[model samples]
Each structure stands twice: as C-alpha cells, then as structure tokens.
Target: MLDNYEDILTVNDLADMLKIGKNTAYQLINTGQIKSVKLGRIHRIPRQNVIDYIIEKSR
Candidate 1:
C-alpha cells in the first residue's frame, strides 16, 4: 500500500499503514517509540523512523 517509502508520514498515515488506531499511533510517538519532529502543532514522522520501528519490533 506504500507508494513511496521515502515520503514523510503524518500520524494518520502511520496509523492507517500500521492498521492501528490514531490514538495508539500517537501513543507510540509520545512514548518515543516512533521518532518524530514537531512543526508547530503538527508532528512529522520520518519514513525511515517507521521502517526502523517495524524492524525493531520484529526483532
């Protein structure tokens, strides 16, 4: 479903991709499990961070 692995992802995007709830995705970001950058009120999650998180969890 991922068209571009290099593109940055929003919280909603991450949630949809992982098939998780929005709150859970936010929790992961808040807990620092998924790295993110804050832009004012918006959080931008790097594509690589999501990939890394998946890899870490798989191991």
Candidate 2:
C-alpha cells in the first residue's frame, strides 16, 4: 500500500523502528553506520537505503 511506504523517515521514526533511543539513532547517522541524505539543513534517512545497508552488512 502507498500508505505503508515512507520515502524519508526521521530520527524518531528510525528510533522507534529500531527500538532504540533518539541519541542512538543520531549516533548511527553520525557514525555512518546508517545511511542518510541531507536536504538543506535537514538529515533524512531513506528507508530503502537503511534496509539495504542492514542487509548488506548482514551478508
């Protein structure tokens, strides 16, 4: 469903998804463990990219 798709997820969204803290989410973003894109002054994590990164790392 289109509603099930989220192109960009915020830090809170990522934290909730990963069941971690906001600080941890920010740490992942900062440490490059999680992939993200910056729009203007905002940082957004692409859901697909995060999934892909996890999958790649798992392998």
Candidate 3:
C-alpha cells in the first residue's frame, strides 16, 4: 500500500504498489499510461497520477 502523504514514487515503488514487475512499470511509463518526469537518469511518478491511473483503468 502507498502512503497517503507520498507525493512522488519511483518505478520500483510503482511496481511494488501495483504488484507487477519492475519492467512492466517501466513499460507503463514508456507507453504513457502513467505520467512521469525524468530527473537526470531517474524517473519520478507523481502519487496522484498513480491514483488516477488506477481510477482510469477501473472504469
């Protein structure tokens, strides 16, 4: 489960939260299903975007 106060999440964190593989999480980001910002070599996903993705997919 994600912390309600978390503002940002990494690919690894996304994988764990979604119960999927790390590569799958990267694919979602690469495919634009989940929005992310690239900071140097690291990708950061906003917590709200993750929640939105879940809501969108559930619909």
- Against the hidden reference, what TM-scores do the models get? 0.90, 0.75, 0.91
The TM-score of candidate 1 is 0.90
lDDT of 2: 0.81
lDDT of 1 by residue, 1-59 (tens): 56654489999999988999999999999999999999999999998899889999999
**Candidate 3 ranges beyond 4 A from true positions:** none
Better of 1 and 2 by lDDT: 1
Error of 2 at 31 (Å): 0.7
Q: Which ten residues in a row have the lowest lDDT in candidate 3?
A: 1-10
User: For all candidates, what are the clash counts?
Assistant: 0, 0, 0
Off by over 4 Å in 2: 1-5
Kindly give the stretch of ten consecutive residues in candidate 2 with the minimal lDDT sum: 1-10
Ranking by lDDT: 3, 1, 2
lDDT of candidate 1 vs native?
A: 0.91
lDDT of 2 by residue, 1-59 (tens): 22354888888888877779999999999899898987887789988877876688889
What value of lDDT does candidate 3 attain over all alpha carbons?
Answer: 0.92
